[model samples]
Target: MSRRPGRVRRAASAALLSLLLVAGCDTGGAEDAGGGQPAASGAAEVPGEIVLASGRDVTGRGGIRQQLITEWNRQQEAKGVAYRARLVELPGSADQQRSQLLGALQSGSAEYDVVNLDVTWVPEFAAAGLVQPLPDRLVDEDVIKSVAETARWGGKLYAAPFNSDVGLLFYRRDYLTSAGVTRPDLGKDAGWPVVQQLIGVLDAARNRLPAAYAKGWTSQLDASYEGLTVNGVEAFASAADGFSLTDKEGRYAGSVAELQAGLDELRNRTQAAYTLPDAVHSDEADTLTDFAAGRTAFLRHWPYAYRTLHQSLSAEQLGVAPLPGKAVLGGQNLAVARGSQRTAAALQLVAFLTGKESERCLLDAGFAATRVSAYEDGALTCTTAKPAGQAAASPTGERTDRMPRDGNGRPAYARGTLLPALENAVQRPRTPLYGAFSQTFAGQLARLQGGTPPSDAQLAADLDRQLKRALPSH
Candidate 1:
């Protein structure tokens, strides 16, 4: 993810490459671009205009914005629709985008009719009445289950799934093969058992490899941030005794007794003898640089890494799979703001963007489409879908954003592994005060990883308190 140098230094280690696919921190700033009614500024919502605000996607040269905005505007005019929709690009930081949106909405002056929200922001937006649940017909009638789940809140759909993302395990294929270990299938192997199996393999060959290969696994740990929360949720979601993050009512869970095993599993993995040194202090970028330099055997990152690394590494040398257990799901969703004169036009815009045709554009632009059919479009050169050496790029270079293609323009990733990971990805805790929760938990998890973990009872109590604090009574 692109950020100012100071902001980059402040990022939680888990979210380095995850700027492409993961949780966001707290909102710290506000910005505005006209077209909304304000409580004090006296700004008036423009007639026949729908403004959509969202964070900038930076996976490629232009950030992952598809041609939907221009195309939609043209289509509307062609169809004799009077309303014209435009995208007001927000800051690259999700936190800052939310802050801007919140400030605008609260002031009653924001003219944004369509708000592009992170998947995790649905509950908070819905709770605050900033955005309205979509009509049944506009919702994805045939979307993938994993992504479809992101649009619903309190049994009602508030948003439409657009693009999606998940964590991936990037490995040195050349190193693994030479070391006589075949990389395990992530979706097939599934969960913590396979993590251990792979861990064992790495441990066994730790001394056998060149001394430069110092660690077997490298992921975000020993820090408190959304990444820590995501790592915990992934482990506990499938761990023997891990509790579900949502209760019977589908709200953020209150009890933590069942989460202990998941936390323990996290401890087990972080404290593993083969983990990269200084990992607790390294952010995603540092670890990625190290991995590219051949310092580690395995890395946990977002799929976007394939693009950046493919500039030099061959498909044979770089392989990606789903993270063991599960990976955190990340991406954006389109919601209609609660107050807008052109709600109908706004909904139409949201539908068009999230539809199959637009999904193809999203994928081509380096974002994972929520529509399953987008992958089947002959354009994507994904290993799971097309034959090896058979791949295609978007006419405008957007397809490279969806999945990586080699110099010969062949598929550089195994969609078989990557797709399933995105499909099975889980959410971090769904709370309005996610930033607060992430900060508190990241600090605690860092303590745990730093060899000063609190007792399970204490950890549980603190977690419950944090979760409550993240979504207190209104």
Candidate 2:
């Protein structure tokens, strides 16, 4: 969820204040001093070492990142390029990750040759000159065109897409059948009203449905980072009306009235049925847990949740659909550190990891792939446990069934649902002050969730003030 950026510093005082307040508390530990120099330049070339600063642990078996890295190692070894990746796990919070990466770059002591960055962080990294811009020849124009646009700043590529993610709608087919309601048509233009009505129908028949299917719908309405960023910002941005908080000119778009209306709609709709009232305070783990436990009839979540949900319920009981509004796109990008001396080798490693073969491996291991070809590859429908092996076929094993389909019957996974959303959906204002913006939004959302019901005018005024202060003119 990181990308490149614009805007310049206003004053020394503001810069110092940001450093003291935001950056000081979150910078991670210094680089490892024990690690010796990077592998020699020509020592069997592929055998060279590359430190990978990962936001998550790569040692975990069956994880997409781990699988991709493992394959890369095998390929490198086979080609006589003995490549070794040492992963330094960083804090998982986006804010913390950005702070740590920025601090490391500024310190010039980070030895990592490859850095896994959130899609949104690309802009900040490029602006700070922390990562190297990808060379034209290394990028696959067709594949990169689809995935690399997010990593660009002023029209230059800064990173390569790693693992792609997007929001998907999940419903209970059994409950829908019991209610005698036909499956809702989830076409490209599906709107909130349609979703609301479907939930309404489910609510009216709650008494007849199983206790676990009583709740009409659920989402991550919590004030946590993920909730705020995804459900609040991403979902709101994709609303038919666009983000109520930001205008087309990248200015404050909504009055307090608009924001309250949006919040009220979200809250009242969920509250009408037996939903988790504290969802506004829950995290991704909690949201996923509730869905897995069958506490709700419908949920909107990332693709990884599909694997976990499949283990808990029969595919027949589960129905996948694209979100009603613009879906939020989330994923990781791989970049070479500007200071690294192994740009060529690192780029080669990145290409191998993001290639069609690696993507196939990722999808087979229960992770989503970024490439369109991977999705179309018949192997995805084949049910196999091996990273790159053919999947074992079952009645429910079809990719068409596993992935959400639009009204037109097209797969509504990352490409169908989120690609358009990225092109037209609301993006967080591309300001260096996003940290402040997110914090303010979270604080205000907490109050609304607590039933404070502040005036829309007041809310808008306060938000405008904060934004202006956060990004004052130089």
Candidate 3:
């Protein structure tokens, strides 16, 4: 799947199709290098090319991640260093990519010096000694507090927070105005009650609404994977004060009463009257399409959707705010492989890629930045990627920038809404057995979405029992 010249690839709202994993074939014309192996004990370190294996960049072809790497390579060349970095995007879903990385690292099959790992995978990889601990300075005060917590295991730094993500509420401002509402800004303080009330107004004005309008809101609630787990976690956290299902050691610490409370919130939010019926079967792609087609007034989505949606929706038609309650923290972290022979250069690459200027570049390209300065410091701008004011050029040579921006060229919502959301976001369970935990948790929550859902108490007891078995118990 080589990219055509001069063609600008926009983010597609479809599931990632399976593709053959080609090493160094279309990576900016880099040569194919053999897999890296562990050097013998006390072996002299050498400067050479380091491979960074990651999942596909959602930012489209030659995305910001690649541009950052290319910039790093250029710096090394100017300094007369022999080290260069190559990015290898593994082909498949996140789960498949995790498995592939695990196999490649454990069996020494791939010569990866660094890996872009999901936040949840930090504990597992660190515990397994698959990745090396990084310097504390790499994650400092400038990094978002809640986000920086994802890079550590047992109080040691295992990875560096790259770009980050949090759930946000995207609403159709036109729909609100159509409902005769004066103020459409559902500010940072807007809660679930406000959302439900606004939904009632939209419902009352359905006669004047678009034909596609059918429900108040939509979200990715598909029961097959992480969608259900994330939405469930948000519900649980919102229901109970300081709710945490597991302890720091990743053991089952939740009681039946707590589970019951969480289940009640989940049920209330997904009631048939408020949520789109298709949400039960919807993933990220489905929910995005439904919102864009005017089927719903409100949407729960990630930051990248801000750019994707703006491509089709004007600023006057769209408005974004913080999620009603808690948002599940998400994004990848950069970790050095334990077997890498270029550990020194690998660390340098990680530092450069996650630095302040680079993070600004990521935010400008539609990724949620991990640093606060990228949002608040209007003086700082992305110097590595495209120029701030340059319009996006399409394959047809048409140039336009539809996404709205602030005075600093950051996304319009970055400082006021997005940064605060990241500061207060909650993480999924951090444990060596997160894989097992997600499967067990999502499987039990699916009962709430069934035709005849079980009572909250019944589901709570069932979830508690299953979670106790899936993870270690106190």
Candidate that would win on lDDT: 3
Q: Write the per-residue lDDT of candidate 2 for residues 1-474, one digit (tens) a residue.
A: 121121221233234322221100111111121122233453334335777787753212334565445545554555555456656778756668878888887787787788888776777687778888886554564352435555666567788777666677777777777777875445566666776777778778878777765466667766657565566665445533655454322345454455555555544445534455535645555566556656677787766665545544565677666666656666788888887767667776677666665554454444556665555544333111132222223256533113333332223344554444434433454443456666777666556555566655566456556655554332
Which of the two, 1 or 3, has more TM-score? 3
- Ranked candidates (TM-score, high to low): 3, 1, 2
| Per-residue alpha-carbon lDDT of candidate 1 for residues 1-474, written as tens digits (9 for 90 to 100) | 122253454453324344333211111111111112222212443557678887765443333342456556655565565667767888645667888998898787778888888887887788788888777765555577788888887788899887787877787777666666765334555555665566667667766666677667777653633455666666666564335565523346646766566677777777657677656655556667667767776787765566656545666677776687767888788898888766766766777677665554455444677877666545533221123233234556443323454343323342466567777787766665556656766665665764566876677677767666655532
lDDT, candidate 3, at 195? 96
**Candidates ranked, most accurate by lDDT first:** 3, 1, 2
Question: Cα deviation in Å at residue 406, candidate 1?
Answer: 12
Q: Higher lDDT: candidate 1 or 3?
A: 3
RMSD to the true structure for each prediction, in A, is 8.0, 11.4, 6.5
lDDT accuracy of residue 262 in candidate 3: 92
| Candidate 3 least-lDDT 10 residues | 17-26
lDDT of each: 0.62, 0.57, 0.84
| lDDT of model 1, residue 161 | 85
The runs of at least 3 residues in candidate 2 whose Cα sits more than 4 Å from the true structure, single-residue gaps closed, are: 1-47, 57-60, 108-110, 144-146, 184-188, 239-275, 377-426, 472-474
> Where in model 3 is the C-alpha error above 4 Å?
1-42
TM-score of each: 0.77, 0.75, 0.91
Greater lDDT among 1 and 2 belongs to: 1
Question: In model 3, which residue pairs have backbone atoms overlapping below 3 Å?
Answer: 36-111
